[model samples]
Target: MTSEADLAWIASVVGDPARLRILLSLMDGRARTAKELAFLARIAAPTASGHLAKLLDSRLVAVEPQGRHRYFRIASPLVAQMVETMSAVAGDASPGDRRLRRIDPALAAARTCYDHLAGRLGVAIADALQARGHVAFGDGSGEVTASGRAFFAALGLDLAEAGHGRRVFCKPCLDWTERRHHIAGGLGAAFCGHCLSAGWIRRHRDSRAVEVSPEGRVALAELLGVDGQALTSGWPERAAA
Candidate 1:
C-alpha cells in the first residue's frame, strides 16, 4: 500500500530537473551508464552519481552490473507507464514546443516509447489488432483475444512465452505525439523486438525515430494489414482504408 509518505518521496525524487532528465533518457528501455546519463542531463559525473543514488534508493531505477560497469534503467513497466502518462498530461497542458514541432512529422511517423513501438506504426498495429478481433480496447486498457494468440503464434511470438513478469501483459499506452493509443506492455515490447529482428524496421543512428523498409511495407500489409508505405509517406492511413 502506498502511504502519503511514499507519495511525497516519489514526488520529491522526480521533481528535480536533472533527475527527471536522467529518467527520461532511460525511458527507451536502454540501460545507460552514469557517464552517459551525466552527459544527457548536462551535469557533472559526480552530480549524476548523487542523483542516481537517490533514484536507486527511491526504487525508481534499477542497476545491473556487467563486468566493471553498472548500467541504470527504469525499475519497472509501472514506472515507465507513470512517466509516459505524466508526459502526456503535461504535453496537453502546454503550448506545443516549437522545436518539437519541427521534428514532429518524423516522430509521429515512427518512434519508440520505452521498449515498445510507438508513433504511427504503433497506433496502426494496435488498430489492426482490434479491427481483426485479435484484441480489444477498454477505457484505457486492452487485452489480447484468442485470435491474437493464434495470430502471434503464426508470427513466431508464443504469447505464453511472454511469461510472468512485473510488467503488464497487454495494454494501450497513449501516444503523446499522435494523440492515439499504441501498444505498450510485455506484448508491445515483444512485437517491437520481433519487428526489429525481422528487418522490418530500423532505428535511426542518432534519433529515436525508426524507418520502415520496403519489405516491411509489404509484410505489414500482408500480416497485420498495416500500410507501412503510406505511413512513411507522411500521411495518416488507417487499416480500414
Candidate 2:
C-alpha cells in the first residue's frame, strides 16, 4: 500500500507545470539533457536545473553522466505510466486553454505512450490485430494468438525476443485521446520499434506526434488492411512531411 507521504510527494513533484512539461518531454523513452528540457519547457536554464533537481531527488526522474554530458529520463516504466495516466485524466481542456487545444489533434493522431504507440494509429492497429485473429483479448489483457505469431514473424518481429524483458508480455492501455484500447506491454513496444525501424512512422522532434510515411501507408494497408490514406487524411502537409 502507498503511504500518505508518498502520495503527497508524488503530488508535489507532479503538480508544477514546468516540471510536468519536462516529464512529458521525456515520455518518448529518450534521455534528454537539461538544456533540451529547458528549451522544451520554455524556462531559463537555472530554473530548469532547479526543477530537474527536485525531480531527481524525488526519484521521479533519473540521470546518466557520460563525460561532460548528463541525460535525464523518467525513472522507470511505472513512472511513465503514472505520468501518462495523469495526462489522460487532466486532458479536459478549459475554454481558454488554447495551447493544449491546439495540440490535441496532433496528439490524437499518432503519439507515443512511453515506449508504445497510443493514439488513433495505435488503436487502429490494435483493432486490426484483433479483427484478423492475430490477438486475443480477455479480462483487461491480451495475448498474441498462433496466427498472430505467424503474422508478426512475417514482419521480422520475433515475439520471443520481444518478450525477453521483465515486463508483461501484453496488456491494454486506454487511449486518452481516442478513448479506446490500444496494446501496451512488450508486444506493443516491439511493434512500435518495428514500425520506426521500417520507416513506417517518423517521430517529430521534441514532440510526441508521429507521421506515417507514404511507405508506411502502403505497408499497413497491405498487411493489416488499414486505410493508410484515411488515417493521415486529416494531417496537415507539414505533419505528413
Candidate 3:
C-alpha cells in the first residue's frame, strides 16, 4: 500500500525542474550517459549528476555500466506512464497557445512514449485498430481480439511472445500531445519494434520524433487503413472532435 508520505516524497523528487528535464530526456527509452543527459537537460555535469543520484535513490531511474561509462534510463514502463500522465496534466495548453507552437512538428506528429508510439500518428493507429475490431479499449486497459491476434500474426509478430513479460500485454496510454489514448504496454512495444524492423518508421537522430517512410504510408494504408501522410503532416482535425 502507498502512503501519503510516499506520494509526497515522489512528488518532491519529480518536481524539481532539472530532475524533470533529466527524466523527460530518458523518456525515449534509450539509456543515456550522464554527460549526454546533462547536455540534453541544459545543466552542468555536476548538477545533472546530483539529480541523477536522487532519481537513482528514488528508483525512478536505473543505471547500467557499459564499458567505462554508465548509462541511465527510466526504471520501468510504470514510471514512464506516471511521467507522461503528469506531463499531460501540466501541459494542458490550449490549441492556440504559443507553447503549442513551440512544439516540434515532427514530435507532435509521431514519437515514442517510452518504448511505444505516441502522438497523433500513434493515436490514429490506435483509432484505426479499434475501428477495425482489432483492439478494444475499456477502462484504461485494452484487449486484443481474436482477429487482432491473427492480424499481428500475419505481420510476423507473435502475441504469445510479446506477452511473456510481467508488463501488461495491452493498455491505453493517454497521449500528452494528442489528448487521446494510444496503445501502450507489451503489445504496443512489440508493434513498435516490428515497425522499426520492417523499416516503416525511422527515429530522429537527435530527438524522439519518428518519420513514417514512404513504404510505411503504403503499408499502413494496406494493412490498417491508417493515413500515414496526414498524420505525419499535421494534427488531424477530426481528432479534435
User: What is the model-wide C-alpha lDDT for candidate 1?
Assistant: 0.78
Candidate 3 stretches greater than 4 Å from native: 1-96, 234-241
Instruction: Judge candidate 3 at residue 224 and give its lDDT.
Output: 75
Question: Could you give candidate 3's per-residue lDDT for residues 69-90 as a string of tens digits?
Answer: 8878877545876876776677
| Global lDDT of model 2 | 0.79
Predicted candidate 2 versus true structure: per-residue lDDT over 85-167, tens digit per residue = 67667885333233334446677788999999977788778877887889887755789999999999888898898889688
Instruction: Count clashing residue pairs in model 3.
Output: 0
Q: For residues 146-234, could you state the per-residue lDDT of candidate 1 as single tens digits?
A: 88888988889867667466768898776655445688988998898898999999998888889888888789878976555655443
Q: For each candidate, what is the lDDT?
A: 0.78, 0.79, 0.82
Which residue ranges in model 1 land beyond 4 Å of their true spot? 1-100, 233-241
**What CA root-mean-square deviation does each model show from the true structure?**
12.6, 13.4, 12.5
Per-residue lDDT of 175 in model 2: 62
C-alpha positional error of residue 59 in candidate 3 after TM-score superposition, expressed in Å: 39
TM-score for each candidate, following the candidate numbering: 0.56, 0.55, 0.58
Q: Measured by TM-score, how close is model 1 to the native structure?
A: 0.56
